[model samples]
Target: MIEMKEVHLIAKLADLQEVDYHNTLVLHALIELLVEKGLLTHEELTAKAHALDSQLSFQLDLASKLSETIQNRHTQIKPIS
Candidate 1:
C-alpha cells in the first residue's frame, strides 16, 4: 500500500503528466503553423524532436537512478524494534 506522503507525490506526478499533454498539443499546433508559413522546415522539426527525445531519455534515466539510490538507502536504514 502506498503511504499517505507517497500518495501526494503520486498525485503531483499525475498533474505534471496532464500538464505536459496539454502543452504538447499546443506545441503541435504551433509547429504546424510554422511549417505552413515556411518559417521552419520539416528537417528542422525532426532534428529538434530528436534532441528533445534525447534530453527526455537522459532525464528519465537519471530519475530512475536517483529513485533506485533512494530506495536502497531507505532499505539500509534499520528500524527501531
Candidate 2:
C-alpha cells in the first residue's frame, strides 16, 4: 500500500512535470518566433546558449569552491569563551 507521504511526493512530481512541459512549449514557441522574424538564427541561438552555459558552469564551480572553503573555515574555528 502507498503511504501518504509517497502520494504527496507523486503529486508534487506530477505538478513539476506539468510545469516543465508548459515552460518547454513556451520556450520553443518563442524561439520559433524569433527565427521566423529573422531576429536571430538557430546557429546564433545555439552559440549563445553554449556560451551562457559555459559561463554559468564556471560560476557554479566557483560558488561551490567558496562554499567548501567556508565550511572548512567554520570547522577549523575555535569557539570563543
lDDT: which candidate is best?
2
Q: Per-residue CA lDDT of candidate 2, range 16-77, in tens?
A: 99999999999999999999999999999999999999999999999999999999999999
Candidate 2, pairs of clashing residues: none
Clashes of 2: 0
Shift in Å, residue 55, candidate 2: 1.0
In model 2, how large is the Cα lDDT of residue 37? Answer: 99
lDDT of 1 by residue, 1-81 (tens): 889999999999999999999999999999999999999998998999899999999999999999999999999999999
Single out the weakest 10-residue window by summed lDDT for candidate 1. 1-10
Predicted structure 1, TM vs. truth:
0.60
| Model 1 stretches astray by more than 4 angstroms | 1-30
Highest TM-score, which number? 2
What is residue 23's positional error in candidate 1, in angstroms? 9.3
